[model samples]
Target: MTATAEAHATRRRTYGAARLLLTLTALAALFATATPAAHAAEPVAQAAYLAARLRADPVYVTDQLPREIPHSTAPAFARLAKRTGVPTYVLVLPGPSGTGKGLLGAVHDRLGRDGLYVLIDASGVSDATAYGVHAPAADAATVALYELPYDAGPLRSFERFVDVVAQGSEKAAQRAASARERYGDEDPAALYLGPSDRDNQSFLTGVLLTAVPALILLLVPYVRRWRRRLPGAKPGRPGAKPGKPGSAKLDSGRKPESGKPESGKPGPGIRHRLGRGLVPAAALAGAAAIALTASLVFDQTRSSAAPPPTAADLTARVHRVTEGLKRDSVYVDPESARVLSAAQLSRLHDRIRAFARSDGGGPVYVLLVPQLTEDESAGQYDVFTATVHRKLGKDGLYVVADPLGGYIEVLNYGLRLDSVGLDLGLPESIGSGDDQAHEADDHALGDRLDALMTYLDKVPRSDEPNTAADYPATPEPVDSHVLRPLFSGDFRPGLLMGALTALFALALTAGVLGIVGKVLRRRNPAPLPTSTLPFTAPTDPSPSYLRRTAHTELSALAEDFRGSAGSGDSGDSGESGDSGESGESGESTHEQPPSGPSGLLPQVRAWDCFDAAMLLVDGDIDALDSPGPGPETLVAVVVLSRAGRAALRGEVNDLCCGVNPLHGPAVSRHHVRVSAEGRRRRLLPVCESCRNTAIVEPATVHTLLMTLPAPAGADGRVPYIETDGPLTAVPNGIPRLIDKVRETAGVQ
Candidate 1:
């Protein structure tokens, strides 16, 4: 065969390999998309199903409420509802802009509670109107009073109205067989769904919109496969020049001989077919991209087309939410609503203090809003407020209208304001002007935001909650919490984790394709005759090439131990030549990695691990020391760093790890050695030994480690210092411990 034919054969082989890869990549992407579906909406659906189930239960009841509320408010509502036989309505508005709309919605919901299902009809009512209190009509089957903030006097009047209604109903019941009969007939119970509930449907809609496109992208490549075919052309005519059209050519990064269709004689081998398969794979990948793009565009268009929540719907929702407010304990602004006496204020302060202790932080806010009767404008208070500062400035309450929302925003920004802000100083410009003061106040509130920030800093979280957020610098797999001990960052170190995943996939694909490629090559080997093309060019003989590889490897091994690095390098004169070779590259082939003395992992520094390990070794050790473990065991907890944790994890699985494996090469092969005291002793390093006896206080070690970020070695080589001698000889001997064990076990 001519040189052109030989080159054509190589081109065919190259195409086959490319085809296989393209096909595999497309398949893998589809698989990745399908697998995450099980997790999609899993948390939301679970939360929704739980809510629905709770709603269906007889004991499950909800109250309508204002957007902002005190922590101690929920119980008061329940108690008031039980004490008074009138349904309560809570009027909650979105903000200053929607006060009228909010109030009307609250009253509408209140009127509908007498019916069996609490039906609400916002049919004719305009969304933008302040609420009114209406006396029930004379002919109405059951008397119901509509109560809300209608005017300057209505708030105090509403309270009086409630008292009168309660009294009148009791008097009327007195005429009945007994007071129990009256009480039973006028049961005061109502339900409300807050703005959160009203907006949940919208949230669900948004989720569906986001997810549907991803699902469609997953389906594309497979659906379009059959319609796509490889482009084909016939081989050149039999007598035509070798470089004719319909020909294939190959260049091996060297000069190409000529172009020609390699398939002039017979069918290509399996390798050639596999190589050609790349074209189809590439086509499939393109289809996947198009499908994903189209789906995203469609989703965006649909999202844009959807209308906002209707006013009537919102009014009805607000009403249903506010009905429970009547039964709730009323909150009068600290600055206004003078009806709340000194005793009430004192009681409120006590509640605030108790809440602060329970929450493990300072009171975040002491919100004071005037009732409608006091002054309509005083009802609104935001982060930016003069009265907010007046009421809470000295008390250190973080006054914000939407405490939770503001907190969420600060947390999302990765600003841990709460844990670090206690010592922070206030800016001088904060109290300059009313508006400036308010802006400063807003910033201060955000700066001091704690509750949400606390959750992010210490709480173990599932990524699903904030999956859409930017990923951290580290990559960790999402797995079950039960396996959290085993799945640590140290187990799979560094930024390299992201690329490890891709490489794993590539390796798996290559392994699968290699087998397929071999089968195809067997039937149709390379097209050109073997004698026509020389198999070898003068480069290096295979044996000599392997010998050189062995020499390079030996040089690397010798340089593994070097002076001023490790103790093993002192006498190894043979390493100098290899060290020189490594130095020429300006990058060390073997650099010393930081480890504990003798490469032992320091467990004592980790209180949790040390305490746990001690407990595992001997239960009687605590009793031998002061304060037995029965009570003291609670105080001891084991803590471990990432590296130490990795060692502990391996130990749990009965694998060689930490000092046990590392000591052999780092220290002497033998465990027994002489110490500085001139006594024969087992050289159990500080990393492997407990700082105190087997019965050490968990807190003692933990506090010590937390204070010292890194361990102190004799000469900076060790991660931990030897604080105490190893327990080579047990105190009072093995026999004493055996006797104690027998006594505890109740052996005669």
Candidate 2:
């Protein structure tokens, strides 16, 4: 193949390879993103297995509850619990359902009769139950078990119940008695239901966040199109038409009509300027306004509809609960600690301390919170492990459990995670809500702790454990709070507002810059050229013949004009010769030529005019010699022919009317021959009356010359004709006329 083809093939192969690589990269990125998401969706069995390992504790709270309870209500409930001598366990479900009994039973089995189980659905439904073992007998009991009235709703009624119980007086007992009397025994099968206002608001906000920006983007293009179609719209580029602004023909640098009003004004009026400038400004302003408004709306919505806490919040809460943990002991809730006897607490503390001593590091900190979502539980485990890893050495284990949610997450910064036979079963084992049915006499919490310590004891230590001095001192805080939800929870609105504000500021800056640039461009317009030469000619000549021909033609034309000026009525000499040579030409009915200086003066001047015209034509032809002639240049040549004819005819008005020198008697031509020749040339009549009158007017000759056309050669030069040859065959007839004038002047 040719070099060009080979190069094209190489480029095509390169492009194909690049495209393939780009496609593969995009697909790989997509797979990389998708794989983690797929992995994060844990299987039901895996969740159950993990749930089974959780250590049940007193006052089990689910992950669904808010991180902090209301101060007004929590203190009252705690007071009520203290007065009743029963621990209060709160179970906050994601939603109300008829199946709440199963969850309640599980909590009841986990904590036993020592605690009061309170089930509060997210929708504000409440159910408070006191087990028979924990409740006082009818004779001794002053306050009967009561449910919040269905009409009052869970949140309000639950708060009221806490207030009534916290009062601890005869009036409070009477109120509880009155509620029991009025509502009677609460239905065991009744389902808790309430409104999820936050969830609904969040859904609506998300929809608007996506749609508003999209609508604004779509409207911008449509608005621009509408503005363009409006009458008297300003063009995008200078010297362009109103509607067809991007037309290619405008680039030719031809002068376009100024957009000034008809009052002979030099520039556009005030109204026109305003109309042109305001439309774009308005479009930009509108987009910015819409974006700003949407951003504000989104911010408000996000703030109002903050999401529930995730794992990070749970982790932070765990840290708060265990802020001042003692060495050689697991950090347990004070209320849960109350449930354990002094001997049991001592034994538990000893076991933990022994484990810490065995590793010569720190005790394995066990945190058993009430309830946390599965995700939050996991996050808590990570946060606790990281905190322990930083505070203690890496050779430590942090186990966090959510007994209310029936799940446990283990974080082993040490070698325990990689311990042999350390599989803790799937999360489903604990989360299946069947643990209560299989409850054994042994305390589930104690058994789980024992199992954990046993596993830790068997875990092989790292062969190259660093000494105490070698360990990092004053380690950096893990900063688990940074992992908190960015566009959710309490900080969502602030984050959204900040981001939108930045975007708006950037857009405003760009818009202002664009407007300023346009104003500056308008203030200082680019200058346009005055002359219209299609192309510039080079000084050097390729072949000597081209330069010689142009010089000779110009020189000969100058000589012809001088000769024609000196001679008087030289046309008769040429006419007499032609007539004598062809006897039939003398018999024609044609006027005799004027024979004097006055008559010849017109022809002399015409020759002089023709000489100057030829010089310009020769120069133009020379400029186009190398590249061949452009279409515009060729058209300009025809226009020059008409101009030359007009100049000649203006000098001699009666030359054609007085005589018809070239006609023969045998022809008796009925039409004036106006030759239009050369490449791509045609012929047309100059004057029909010339034949009838047997007289040729100067106008006829001028007309014939002006309308004549010529073809440029491949090299852009016209063929050089001899001075005395037929003038009509050449473009503009100036070259041939010059030659004829030279011959006539020589004879004189």
- Return the TM-score for candidate 2, rounded to 2 decimals: 0.32
Every model's TM-score: 0.19, 0.32
The local lDDT score (0 to 100) that residue 608 gets in candidate 1 is 24
- Deviating ranges (above 4 Å) for candidate 2: 1-123, 126-271, 299-364, 370-379, 385-398, 405-446, 461-748
Candidate lDDT values, in order: 0.27, 0.38
List the candidate 1 regions with Cα displacement exceeding 4 Å. Answer: 1-342, 346-511, 520-528, 532-748
Model 2: residue 351 alpha-carbon error in angstroms: 4.1
lDDT of 1 by residue, 553-651 (tens): 121211211111121122222222222222232232322223433223222112122222223123222222232222111111111112223332232
Please write out the lDDT profile of model 2 over residues 503-585, one tens digit for every residue: 67556655765575556435322111112111111112134323332332222222222222212221111112221121222
lDDT of model number 2: 0.38
